[model samples]
Target: MNFKEHIRVIEDFPQQGIRFKDITTLLKNGQMYKAAIDELREKVKHLEIDLIAGPEARGFVVGAPLAYALDVGFIPIRKSGKLPGETIEADYNLEYGKDKLAMHKDAILPGQKVLIADDLLATGGTIQTSIDLIKQLGGEVIGSAFMIELMSLNGRDKLPSELEIITLMQY
Candidate 1:
Protein backbone atom coordinates (compact mmCIF):
# COMPACT_ATOMS: atom_id res chain seq x y z
CA MET A 1 0.00 0.00 0.00
CA ASN A 2 3.04 2.26 -0.16
CA PHE A 3 2.75 3.27 3.49
CA LYS A 4 5.90 5.36 3.24
CA GLU A 5 3.99 8.02 1.34
CA HIS A 6 1.96 8.70 4.45
CA ILE A 7 4.93 9.08 6.78
CA ARG A 8 6.47 12.42 7.67
CA VAL A 9 10.23 12.59 8.00
CA ILE A 10 11.95 15.44 9.82
CA GLU A 11 15.70 15.98 9.62
CA ASP A 12 17.70 16.50 12.81
CA PHE A 13 14.73 15.93 15.01
CA PRO A 14 15.15 15.40 18.79
CA GLN A 15 18.89 15.81 18.15
CA GLN A 16 21.48 16.89 15.64
CA GLY A 17 22.12 14.55 12.70
CA ILE A 18 19.07 12.48 13.52
CA ARG A 19 16.20 11.97 11.09
CA PHE A 20 12.91 11.02 12.66
CA LYS A 21 10.18 9.21 10.78
CA ASP A 22 6.87 10.29 12.23
CA ILE A 23 3.83 8.06 11.79
CA THR A 24 1.29 10.66 12.88
CA THR A 25 0.77 11.56 9.24
CA LEU A 26 -0.34 8.03 8.52
CA LEU A 27 -2.19 7.75 11.82
CA LYS A 28 -4.34 10.78 11.08
CA ASN A 29 -5.60 9.18 7.94
CA GLY A 30 -8.07 6.52 9.03
CA GLN A 31 -7.83 4.55 5.84
CA MET A 32 -4.10 4.44 5.90
CA TYR A 33 -4.01 3.51 9.58
CA LYS A 34 -6.44 0.68 9.06
CA ALA A 35 -4.54 -0.54 6.05
CA ALA A 36 -1.29 -0.61 7.97
CA ILE A 37 -2.84 -2.51 10.87
CA ASP A 38 -4.62 -4.86 8.47
CA GLU A 39 -1.38 -5.51 6.69
CA LEU A 40 0.35 -6.22 9.99
CA ARG A 41 -2.48 -8.50 10.96
CA GLU A 42 -1.93 -10.46 7.76
CA LYS A 43 1.76 -10.82 8.47
CA VAL A 44 1.36 -12.11 12.02
CA LYS A 45 -1.94 -13.93 11.85
CA HIS A 46 -0.22 -17.25 11.38
CA LEU A 47 1.50 -17.06 14.74
CA GLU A 48 -0.10 -18.42 17.89
CA ILE A 49 -0.16 -15.19 19.84
CA ASP A 50 -1.94 -15.12 23.20
CA LEU A 51 -1.52 -11.37 23.70
CA ILE A 52 -0.03 -8.28 22.05
CA ALA A 53 2.36 -6.28 24.22
CA GLY A 54 3.58 -2.78 23.48
CA PRO A 55 5.47 -0.01 25.25
CA GLU A 56 3.96 3.19 26.48
CA ALA A 57 2.84 6.18 24.31
CA ARG A 58 3.24 5.46 20.59
CA GLY A 59 3.33 1.73 21.10
CA PHE A 60 -0.16 1.85 22.50
CA VAL A 61 -1.45 3.46 19.34
CA VAL A 62 -0.16 0.71 17.07
CA GLY A 63 -0.50 -2.22 19.44
CA ALA A 64 -4.04 -1.75 20.66
CA PRO A 65 -5.60 -1.61 17.23
CA LEU A 66 -3.55 -4.51 15.99
CA ALA A 67 -4.53 -6.57 18.99
CA TYR A 68 -8.19 -5.82 18.32
CA ALA A 69 -7.80 -6.78 14.69
CA LEU A 70 -6.05 -9.97 15.73
CA ASP A 71 -8.78 -10.73 18.32
CA VAL A 72 -6.23 -11.06 21.12
CA GLY A 73 -5.87 -9.23 24.40
CA PHE A 74 -3.61 -6.16 24.62
CA ILE A 75 -0.97 -5.85 27.34
CA PRO A 76 0.42 -2.39 27.84
CA ILE A 77 4.10 -2.10 28.66
CA ARG A 78 4.26 1.31 30.29
CA LYS A 79 6.87 3.53 31.88
CA SER A 80 7.65 2.90 35.55
CA GLY A 81 4.83 4.04 37.92
CA LYS A 82 2.32 4.45 35.11
CA LEU A 83 0.64 1.20 35.97
CA PRO A 84 -1.41 0.76 39.15
CA GLY A 85 -0.73 -2.81 40.23
CA GLU A 86 2.48 -4.50 41.22
CA THR A 87 4.68 -4.39 38.12
CA ILE A 88 8.06 -5.54 36.91
CA GLU A 89 10.40 -3.18 35.09
CA ALA A 90 13.39 -3.32 32.79
CA ASP A 91 15.68 -0.42 32.02
CA TYR A 92 16.60 0.62 28.48
CA ASN A 93 18.40 3.32 26.53
CA LEU A 94 16.70 5.62 24.09
CA GLU A 95 18.04 7.50 21.14
CA TYR A 96 17.85 10.63 23.24
CA GLY A 97 18.30 9.18 26.73
CA LYS A 98 17.46 6.30 29.04
CA ASP A 99 14.18 5.12 30.56
CA LYS A 100 12.51 2.16 32.19
CA LEU A 101 9.34 0.28 31.21
CA ALA A 102 6.99 -1.61 33.47
CA MET A 103 4.48 -4.33 32.93
CA HIS A 104 1.88 -5.72 35.32
CA LYS A 105 3.05 -8.78 37.18
CA ASP A 106 -0.08 -10.65 36.19
CA ALA A 107 -0.25 -9.43 32.62
CA ILE A 108 0.95 -12.64 31.12
CA LEU A 109 0.27 -16.21 32.12
CA PRO A 110 3.19 -18.55 32.35
CA GLY A 111 4.43 -19.70 28.94
CA GLN A 112 1.89 -17.53 27.12
CA LYS A 113 2.94 -16.52 23.61
CA VAL A 114 3.36 -12.75 23.10
CA LEU A 115 4.06 -10.50 20.14
CA ILE A 116 5.57 -7.09 20.83
CA ALA A 117 4.40 -4.17 18.73
CA ASP A 118 5.48 -0.55 18.58
CA ASP A 119 5.42 2.52 16.35
CA LEU A 120 9.14 2.58 15.60
CA LEU A 121 12.16 0.33 15.97
CA ALA A 122 15.17 2.59 16.41
CA THR A 123 17.90 1.33 18.78
CA GLY A 124 16.06 -1.87 19.79
CA GLY A 125 16.48 -0.92 23.43
CA THR A 126 12.75 -0.53 24.06
CA ILE A 127 11.88 -3.83 22.43
CA GLN A 128 14.81 -5.58 24.02
CA THR A 129 13.79 -4.33 27.44
CA SER A 130 10.22 -5.32 26.67
CA ILE A 131 11.49 -8.77 25.82
CA ASP A 132 13.28 -8.91 29.16
CA LEU A 133 10.14 -7.94 31.08
CA ILE A 134 8.05 -10.46 29.17
CA LYS A 135 10.58 -13.22 29.77
CA GLN A 136 10.80 -12.30 33.42
CA LEU A 137 7.06 -12.89 33.61
CA GLY A 138 7.54 -16.27 31.93
CA GLY A 139 5.95 -15.33 28.64
CA GLU A 140 7.52 -16.53 25.43
CA VAL A 141 8.09 -13.71 22.96
CA ILE A 142 6.92 -15.19 19.70
CA GLY A 143 7.92 -12.18 17.59
CA SER A 144 8.06 -8.42 17.37
CA ALA A 145 6.47 -5.96 14.94
CA PHE A 146 6.86 -2.30 14.13
CA MET A 147 5.46 0.32 11.79
CA ILE A 148 8.89 1.62 10.84
CA GLU A 149 12.49 0.42 11.11
CA LEU A 150 15.66 2.46 10.80
CA MET A 151 18.12 0.08 9.18
CA SER A 152 21.21 2.19 9.80
CA LEU A 153 20.67 1.96 13.56
CA ASN A 154 21.17 -1.85 13.42
CA GLY A 155 18.56 -2.28 16.15
CA ARG A 156 18.07 -5.93 15.30
CA ASP A 157 21.58 -6.74 16.44
CA LYS A 158 20.54 -6.29 20.08
CA LEU A 159 17.63 -8.72 19.81
CA PRO A 160 17.70 -12.46 20.07
CA SER A 161 18.97 -14.20 16.95
CA GLU A 162 15.93 -16.41 16.54
CA LEU A 163 13.19 -13.88 17.28
CA GLU A 164 11.13 -13.00 14.23
CA ILE A 165 10.71 -9.30 13.43
CA ILE A 166 8.25 -7.62 11.09
CA THR A 167 8.22 -4.01 9.97
CA LEU A 168 5.84 -2.31 7.56
CA MET A 169 8.37 0.20 6.28
CA GLN A 170 12.09 0.94 6.53
CA TYR A 171 13.98 4.21 6.58
Candidate 2:
Protein backbone atom coordinates (compact mmCIF):
# COMPACT_ATOMS: atom_id res chain seq x y z
CA MET A 1 0.00 0.00 0.00
CA ASN A 2 3.02 2.29 -0.31
CA PHE A 3 2.70 3.01 3.40
CA LYS A 4 5.80 5.15 3.24
CA GLU A 5 3.81 7.79 1.42
CA HIS A 6 1.63 8.25 4.49
CA ILE A 7 4.61 8.99 6.71
CA ARG A 8 6.06 12.44 7.37
CA VAL A 9 9.79 12.71 7.78
CA ILE A 10 10.99 15.55 9.96
CA GLU A 11 14.66 16.41 9.79
CA ASP A 12 16.51 17.32 13.01
CA PHE A 13 13.44 16.69 15.12
CA PRO A 14 14.03 16.56 18.90
CA GLN A 15 17.70 17.11 17.91
CA GLN A 16 19.94 17.90 14.95
CA GLY A 17 21.23 15.33 12.43
CA ILE A 18 18.33 13.04 13.26
CA ARG A 19 15.43 12.35 10.93
CA PHE A 20 12.26 11.24 12.68
CA LYS A 21 9.61 9.35 10.72
CA ASP A 22 6.37 10.60 12.17
CA ILE A 23 3.34 8.30 11.90
CA THR A 24 0.80 10.86 13.07
CA THR A 25 0.05 11.80 9.50
CA LEU A 26 -0.77 8.23 8.65
CA LEU A 27 -2.63 7.71 11.89
CA LYS A 28 -4.84 10.71 11.27
CA ASN A 29 -6.07 9.19 8.04
CA GLY A 30 -8.75 6.70 9.12
CA GLN A 31 -8.59 4.43 6.10
CA MET A 32 -4.80 4.35 6.10
CA TYR A 33 -4.60 3.58 9.79
CA LYS A 34 -6.97 0.62 9.46
CA ALA A 35 -5.09 -0.60 6.42
CA ALA A 36 -1.83 -0.41 8.37
CA ILE A 37 -3.22 -2.43 11.27
CA ASP A 38 -4.68 -4.96 8.87
CA GLU A 39 -1.36 -5.22 7.06
CA LEU A 40 0.55 -5.68 10.30
CA ARG A 41 -2.01 -8.24 11.42
CA GLU A 42 -1.49 -10.18 8.20
CA LYS A 43 2.27 -10.16 8.70
CA VAL A 44 2.12 -11.64 12.19
CA LYS A 45 -1.13 -13.63 12.14
CA HIS A 46 0.67 -16.87 11.53
CA LEU A 47 2.82 -16.59 14.64
CA GLU A 48 0.10 -17.88 16.99
CA ILE A 49 0.46 -14.71 19.02
CA ASP A 50 -1.13 -14.96 22.44
CA LEU A 51 -0.68 -11.32 23.32
CA ILE A 52 0.52 -7.99 21.93
CA ALA A 53 2.81 -6.01 24.24
CA GLY A 54 3.60 -2.42 23.39
CA PRO A 55 5.77 0.16 25.12
CA GLU A 56 4.19 3.43 26.25
CA ALA A 57 2.64 6.14 24.12
CA ARG A 58 3.07 5.28 20.44
CA GLY A 59 3.18 1.60 21.24
CA PHE A 60 -0.40 1.78 22.46
CA VAL A 61 -1.50 3.29 19.17
CA VAL A 62 -0.10 0.34 17.23
CA GLY A 63 -0.43 -2.56 19.61
CA ALA A 64 -3.91 -1.99 20.97
CA PRO A 65 -5.53 -1.92 17.55
CA LEU A 66 -3.45 -4.85 16.34
CA ALA A 67 -4.37 -6.83 19.40
CA TYR A 68 -8.03 -6.12 18.77
CA ALA A 69 -7.60 -7.20 15.15
CA LEU A 70 -5.86 -10.36 16.30
CA ASP A 71 -8.43 -10.96 19.06
CA VAL A 72 -5.76 -11.16 21.75
CA GLY A 73 -5.07 -9.11 24.84
CA PHE A 74 -2.88 -6.01 24.78
CA ILE A 75 -0.29 -5.44 27.48
CA PRO A 76 0.95 -1.97 28.24
CA ILE A 77 4.63 -1.48 28.86
CA ARG A 78 5.05 1.91 30.46
CA LYS A 79 7.64 4.13 32.05
CA SER A 80 8.47 3.39 35.66
CA GLY A 81 5.72 4.56 38.04
CA LYS A 82 3.20 4.93 35.26
CA LEU A 83 1.52 1.66 36.19
CA PRO A 84 -0.27 0.88 39.41
CA GLY A 85 -0.26 -2.38 41.36
CA GLU A 86 2.62 -4.87 41.34
CA THR A 87 4.97 -4.33 38.42
CA ILE A 88 8.34 -5.33 37.10
CA GLU A 89 10.70 -2.89 35.44
CA ALA A 90 13.61 -3.17 33.06
CA ASP A 91 16.28 -0.54 32.48
CA TYR A 92 17.30 0.45 28.95
CA ASN A 93 19.78 2.81 27.39
CA LEU A 94 18.39 5.78 25.49
CA GLU A 95 20.28 8.01 23.10
CA TYR A 96 21.17 10.38 25.94
CA GLY A 97 20.97 8.17 28.98
CA LYS A 98 19.13 5.32 30.70
CA ASP A 99 15.39 4.87 31.17
CA LYS A 100 13.15 2.20 32.56
CA LEU A 101 9.95 0.52 31.33
CA ALA A 102 7.52 -1.21 33.61
CA MET A 103 4.83 -3.79 33.03
CA HIS A 104 2.33 -5.33 35.40
CA LYS A 105 3.65 -8.46 37.02
CA ASP A 106 0.70 -10.48 35.79
CA ALA A 107 0.48 -9.02 32.33
CA ILE A 108 1.57 -12.22 30.64
CA LEU A 109 0.89 -15.75 31.72
CA PRO A 110 3.78 -18.20 31.94
CA GLY A 111 5.00 -19.55 28.58
CA GLN A 112 2.46 -17.51 26.61
CA LYS A 113 3.56 -16.16 23.24
CA VAL A 114 4.01 -12.39 22.89
CA LEU A 115 4.48 -9.98 20.00
CA ILE A 116 6.12 -6.64 20.79
CA ALA A 117 4.77 -3.65 18.92
CA ASP A 118 6.01 -0.06 18.65
CA ASP A 119 6.00 2.91 16.29
CA LEU A 120 9.73 3.02 15.54
CA LEU A 121 12.80 0.91 16.01
CA ALA A 122 15.79 3.23 16.17
CA THR A 123 18.35 1.67 18.54
CA GLY A 124 16.50 -1.50 19.67
CA GLY A 125 17.09 -0.59 23.31
CA THR A 126 13.39 -0.17 24.09
CA ILE A 127 12.29 -3.35 22.37
CA GLN A 128 15.20 -5.30 23.85
CA THR A 129 14.24 -4.14 27.29
CA SER A 130 10.66 -5.09 26.54
CA ILE A 131 11.84 -8.56 25.60
CA ASP A 132 13.53 -8.83 28.98
CA LEU A 133 10.31 -7.92 30.78
CA ILE A 134 8.36 -10.47 28.78
CA LYS A 135 10.91 -13.19 29.40
CA GLN A 136 11.15 -12.40 33.08
CA LEU A 137 7.42 -13.08 33.28
CA GLY A 138 7.97 -16.42 31.48
CA GLY A 139 6.39 -15.20 28.27
CA GLU A 140 8.08 -16.19 25.03
CA VAL A 141 8.79 -13.30 22.65
CA ILE A 142 8.01 -14.88 19.32
CA GLY A 143 8.32 -11.70 17.26
CA SER A 144 8.17 -7.90 17.07
CA ALA A 145 6.40 -5.46 14.75
CA PHE A 146 7.08 -1.82 14.02
CA MET A 147 5.56 0.90 11.86
CA ILE A 148 8.96 2.24 10.79
CA GLU A 149 12.59 1.20 11.01
CA LEU A 150 15.73 3.29 10.63
CA MET A 151 17.96 0.76 8.91
CA SER A 152 21.12 2.86 9.06
CA LEU A 153 20.88 2.74 12.84
CA ASN A 154 21.04 -1.08 12.78
CA GLY A 155 18.44 -1.31 15.51
CA ARG A 156 17.53 -4.84 14.53
CA ASP A 157 21.07 -6.03 15.34
CA LYS A 158 20.47 -5.55 19.05
CA LEU A 159 17.46 -7.88 19.03
CA PRO A 160 17.78 -11.60 19.51
CA SER A 161 18.71 -13.62 16.41
CA GLU A 162 15.69 -15.92 16.64
CA LEU A 163 13.10 -13.19 16.96
CA GLU A 164 10.98 -12.43 13.91
CA ILE A 165 11.00 -8.68 13.24
CA ILE A 166 8.57 -6.94 10.88
CA THR A 167 8.37 -3.31 9.82
CA LEU A 168 5.87 -1.62 7.51
CA MET A 169 8.28 1.11 6.38
CA GLN A 170 12.05 1.53 6.37
CA TYR A 171 14.38 4.46 5.80
What CA root-mean-square deviation does each model show from the true structure? 0.7, 0.9
lDDT of 1 by residue, 1-171 (tens): 899999999999989988889899999999999999999999999999999998998999999999999999999999999999999988899988899999999999999999999999989999999999999999999999999999889998889998999999988
Q: How many clashes show up per model?
A: 0, 0
- The local lDDT score (0 to 100) that residue 127 gets in candidate 1 is 96
The CA lDDT at 41 in model 1 is: 96
lDDT of each: 0.95, 0.94
How many Å off is the CA of 36 in candidate 1?
0.1
Candidate 1 runs further than 4 Å off? none
Worst 10 residues of 2 by lDDT: 90-99
Q: Each candidate's TM vs. the true structure?
A: 0.98, 0.97
Worst 10 residues of 1 by lDDT: 88-97
